[model samples]
Target: MSANKGFETKVPENEGMDSGYMSGLVSELASGPLSEPISEVGSDSGKRISVSVEEEQLDSGLDLQISEQLSNLSFKDVTPTTQPLLVDLEEHKPSIIPQLDRLFMQDDDGDTQLHIASVHGCQKSVSTLIKVCPQRAWMDVSNDYGHTALHLAVLSGHDVVTRMLVLAGASLDVRDVSGRTPLHLAVEARDERCIKSLVIPSPNTPREKMVRILNMRDYTGQTCVHYAARAGRFDIIHLLVNCGADILAGEGLAGWTALHMAARAGDAALARAILDKYGAAAAARDFAGRSPRRLAARTAAAPAFAAHRRDDTDTDSDSEDDYDSESDEQESLFEKLVQLNNPINVV
Candidate 1:
């Protein structure tokens, strides 16, 4: 009964290898699980495929979340949201957040898209903007020169745009940097359609408001009627008067009415129209106490008045002498006779 007799010595399985090398390999395998080394794991094609799949799933989840958010938001069709002169916005469909603000974004000169569209006579864009505009005040947004969309429309002689702006509730009382309103600019431009669009009362603009705008004068103290008379636009004067323009309203400095400006401009036809319509304007004296009649004598209107008097000479020979003597006396005293004494002699 000895230990040597009970346990026999066991030899290595690979008898051809060195015993030290075999011992080292056995110790390395025993130190860890029988798995690949770190370098080999990194190079595994299966591991690489799994990692790529994970990344793709993460990216797809993020895209789905963003699309859900966009679907919940209100989208506006802002396709026509650019300047018609620079770009053809009709072809592009870029989306924006709070699209109404984009329509009002001003340029370097403080002109909005509405201003550009209005000046270019882009009625389609103008209508689109007006339809989607959140507020009426946005249409009145002015440029660097204090020119609103309405001002530009009238200045550009776009009667349709002018009417559209007016119907959209653009203010007529808004004055430009020159103190000229849209109505004043229309009259100066002699744009009859634009003038009618501005002066005519609509459901949005009542008769009272139209009257107030008609009476408004520029920095030069000239109203629309005053400009019409100076330009010798008798038809415009008639239109203005019919639309309730205050012909008796005097201008700023000299207190000259439209009649006074017409007389001073030597426009007999204009002077006659104003006098016939508003007779009191003839008696209305200037700051210098010069009536329209007095102002006419020094102008070319004097010859026209004399000719008109000759035209009215009595056809009967019996009254020829009386008519000639009266005409001579009237011609001499035309400038001196006051409305108080001469009973309102219109030029």
Candidate 2:
């Protein structure tokens, strides 16, 4: 082992590696085996490798110190000469959520630690961050598109993370730049668990403003039910309906109701569910004054259903066969509701 003698390679006067940091690393290496070879790559560019300490043998204090070094150094500068020293990856992992503020890895779009964890489905990090991070962060932190932790979690389909964020005080109704709430994202993503997490409050907890939460419309004035219908997620539609979402609620973009969305897709189970559960919406008209039945008739499924009805006319002379009379037109329209396929379990 030598002193501050031959190893002192003065860094340039301008700017480069932290001088104190470089000296400290070199001084530590001076205590190790003398025969360790220096990196050949650095030889051309004044780069020098010195450390030869056994990484795993370092105790907790050294482990943390080494972890800091690992964070600050690239492999080119810190590679071991004789044998590779494998740093314990666990020690370097950002375990504490608040530590994100000090970390160099900033999430894309300036998303707070909570948003990144939520987007990645890091449940533990999300839960901890919510509890310990500044309240203002949870309340106000949003990414470039104005998505909060809750919105990202729901959109990313992370159910546990979504619930944890909500319970930890993230706003359930926080809207994104597009004015979409977590519930809207959940519906659009068709994530059942996330939908329930956002819509259904925890047991023993008082419900959120039920009317506001379930019926809260996005910028387009469409509610969760509208998204559910469009996605053909009958279960989600049923869930929102049970939550008191209006089946006839008008969408902002086209003023189309949930029924209109269902009918446009020719999702018979959804249309039937709306009809069976809330009969008025079945006959409701959109901004274009087109009834769901009319919208439904325009769909590919509608022609398929009509074709099915026509082909089956040989066996059963249903009301469709009686459509020669105008009175049977209404009855004929009613039979257009069954489907190309029954994916939804409607009662």
- Which candidate number maximizes TM-score? 1
lDDT of 1: 0.59
User: For candidate 2, what is the TM-score?
Assistant: 0.55
Over the stretch 58-91, how does candidate 1's per-residue lDDT look in tens digits? 1111111112222222212212222111111121
lDDT of 2: 0.51
Residue 151 displacement in candidate 2 (angstroms) = 1.7
In the range 1-347, model 2's lDDT, one tens digit per residue, is 01112442222323233222123322232233211332222222454433332322222121111123212322122222232222111211223222333321235455554555566665444433432232333444667777776776676666666655654446766677666788888788777767766555432123447556788876656678877877877777777776667767887645678777776677776666666666666456655455566556645445423332222212223333433444334323333423212313333
Worst lDDT window (10 residues) for model 1? 49-58
Give per-candidate clash totals. Answer: 0, 1
lDDT (C-alpha, whole model) for all candidates: 0.59, 0.51
Clashing pairs in 2: 220-252
Which residues of candidate 1, in runs, are more than 4 Å off?
1-97, 303-347
TM-score of 1: 0.60
Off by over 4 Å in 2: 1-108, 136-139, 203-208, 300-347
